[model samples]
Target: MADVEEMLDQAREMPYGEARSILLEQALKAAAHDRELAFEVRLELTEAYQYGAEPAKSFATFSRSVAEYDADPGRWSDWHTYSLLWQFKWIASDMRRFPEIPLQRAYDALEEMERRYTQAGYGSHAIHTQRTYVAEHIGDRAAADEWFHRWQTTPRDDMSDCEGCDPSGKVWHLAWMGRDEEAIELAAPVVAGHLTCHVQPQGILSNLLLPYVRTGRLEAAAAAHLRAYRLVQGDANYVDDFGDHMEFCALTGNETRGLEILQRELPLLDRSPTPSDRMHFAGCAALLLRRLEDLGHGGLTVRRDGSDVPLDRLRAELESDARDLAARFDARNGTGEQTRRLEARLAAEPLVEHLPLTPHARRVAIPVTQPVAPPPPPAPPSCSTWPRRPGGAATSTPPSPRGSVTTPSAARRTGGARTRSGWRPSWKASRRRPCGCGSARPSCTGRRATRCGGRSRSAGSACSPRTWLWWRRPTGGCSRTATRAGAAARCPAWPRPTRGPAGPRKRSPRSRARRRARCCHCWPSCRSTSPSRWRRPARPGRR
Candidate 1:
């Protein structure tokens, strides 16, 4: 027993790989001398092999531990029970990496552990969560939901050891169900707390990006993406989470960087990648490339490790790989109905489709064709309420006779203007015109009015008689409606100079030549008559 303890200590301290494996092997040999010690050593060996990424070896060692435990069914300890349950959880995770191993095998292992040690009092939450995750990957949504509900409802004992396991699974479940806000609310604090674990930080933050982006929390989403990227910076086995991270980069204006990472990781992924991993990476790559293309960046070349390839070609390659992976899955899994369905989903046409990113509801201002007219004068005020003058004093003066011309001071006081012909309502008064900018603010209407052809002219300009026309022409152009009878007729064909001498400026030969070249370049059909003069001179060796 002392020798076994020393071996375990050495194995734990040593870095993973050959050295630790040797120490663990020695411990396993020493443990065999006693049945109880052998059981303990076998558990440690299983964990060591798992951490070393030797799933097959870990699975075998774990089977041996289970066998040893079964041999002495009548005698059991809490440590043995807990070890068995932990092994069961990890086996499910292993099954994901090795699809040939039926997931049911892991499910049965957990059930056997539960039956053999019912009194050991292990919390069933972790087990249920693992089973739910397995069921989801295997396309058993109904069973997954059932197990998830069981996990959520299970009571945790004070002695439960896996307190940090809930966030990742819960966030994924809630996000999948479209309860994104609730998921974000639950996950944000946990991520901020900086918990460190294989499934956490990286896993939680990766999944959190989905809801964060959907809710328009772009800054939070960007932070989560960066944190997740740092967490898995060089870890290639995290291919499962790489897809989500790439998605975050693509959606948040980092598609180039995401492609660079993909190229760097391609070699690693090509070595021993599972069908699922390949499928996921391919999907993410295709989607990111598609997004880049949609943003008018098509034909962009990605250069990495001395190789250059256009994004379109990369997308095509990924799509082909995805299809091949789906075919392999179908071949291995057989043509059963469920396998067929899963394969179809995996190989569906349109390798990449945009994910729905819903934005918050807010009013969007659209350009109005005609300016909004100001409100009409209030129906002649009732005698009950006396009209107040512009100076805010109650006016005893009876309403001006319908067409009477009043002094400018009287017009200002009455909120009306007296033109030479008649009295105009307050809205029609020059001072109270609506701002034609489409903003509802009454003060902005005439502050900066646009002239003919949408040209913005300063207020009180005498160039043209400006009416509130929402549709203005481009600057220096005449408006069609204005030219018909209003502002356009009075406005010059081109804006008159505000200050400089108004005649055309003389151009130097060089400037004239530059203008001619520009005109020819912009309109190819209008090529310059002296093409040879504008053409570049030939190099010594070139024609």
Candidate 2:
């Protein structure tokens, strides 16, 4: 018989989280007092929250176990009895968070368990189970199957009865690895056989549903998932209710419900004392969100105020709460990366846009017809031949020149002008001339320009030089010389002034210097400037 006091002593030396499993088992195996096992039991239940966001609490527990065994290895003889249970719990919890633990660590854990059992001699069944697990985890399906066969054939104790539960577990592993047919075959018997067994069968059955889903037997998958759901409550063994339920919902395309459950469960689980617990919950939440998005559904959902809001909205609300909590908590002594990570996770939720405005929500009136712009004036008629002035020297009463125009108002009429009010004879010429200071000189003062079309009492006063050169009539009192002066004053273009000496050209040294720097800031186009000076600063107001 195992020594109960020695086992409790073994547990008392361990950290509560690690010690709890062994202590509780020892309490049962030895019928030890309640006070001795209570502490470890509580610690075991809270282990997940204690290891928040960590990959596994088993690693820490295993590390502690190794240290304790190193001092005296025999203390673990009975402890190894619970090795499979602890390892399974560890692996389940670990996988929920860090699915990618290094292959070597897994191999070592399996090898270590094998070595311990080989030394113990009576642990061959447990050894086979663990070996199969390791082999499967490392992608050795054939080896895993061989070990599973070995587990089936190996001799039994009362502890070995639990080994059948492992086949259901194997089904999940096979399904995950894409060997669905084999997984289903292995799971078929247990699905029917083990439901009546003494051991709580939810863990393995839930695991088997994955294979059924993967194999495309949706009806079978749904049946198994619902069965597992009913089987997990108040179990003698472990139950990942939220995670299993999530898998069930996701595979069946009940995404909306899956997300709703996740949003609800995540917070309640985070309050668990073990860090490992928090990681498990967080990892599940993350995985569910990721899976929903993968399946083309939006992530989780939540109830806000009175309505069902998307997870994104709920997360935003939480993030605002986190800032207030952070300030209130005096974070220096409280949870470290965990609080920060939780806040960050809450903040990472995508921003949600509210629903479209309803008719009742609107307070302002909108115009029915967009305000129409006033219709533009009709355009002038374009002509291929030069316009003729009536009763002029050109072709009628007299003969002048082809390019010359009549008075400005008469010129406008022949150009076939159109006006906003109505067509007018002088409108075309009146519209074409610049009325402001910044008009371009050459184009406006060329041989093409017509004389101002309004009737004029004066000679050249009413007509510019361009008009005299191009006009047909010279009735204005203003002299033609004054018109020439106006053109010369306004423009310094080509064809030199016809009647007077040219004006002196004034220049500014400052202006010349400034003009040279114009393209200094523009590279490539102004290659004369050095490349380094391409970004030269503007000289105060000069640009």
Between which residue pairs do clashes occur in model 1? 434-445, 435-444, 435-445, 436-445, 453-472, 453-473, 453-474, 454-472, 454-473, 482-488
Error at 182, model 2, angstroms: 4.2
lDDT string for model 1 (1-543, tens) is 898888888888886555677788888887777888778778878877766535567878877777777787668787677677667767766665555765567667667645543556556666677677766665566887898789878876533334455677888987876789989877765687754455567778888886887887776776787777778765655675777777665665665566666776666556423557667777776777776777667757766446888878878887777666655554544433234433444333331222222244232222224578999875432223333325676534222211112223323554754443223335334333233232223343356663433455545332221233211112212221222223223322222324448765665555543333221112111123324433332334544
| Candidate 2 lDDT over residue span 301-335, tens digit each | 55544577675554344444444433332232223
Scanning candidate 1 in windows of ten residues, the lowest lDDT window is 518-527
lDDT of 2 at 415: 79
Which segments of candidate 2 are over 4 A away from where they belong?
1-106, 138-161, 177-182, 193-199, 213-219, 231-241, 268-543
Q: Candidate 1's error at 213, in angstroms? A: 0.4
RMSD of 1: 21.2
Off by over 4 Å in 1: 1-5, 14-38, 74-77, 117-119, 158-161, 194-199, 271-275, 292-317, 324-543
Error of 2 at 404 (Å): 93
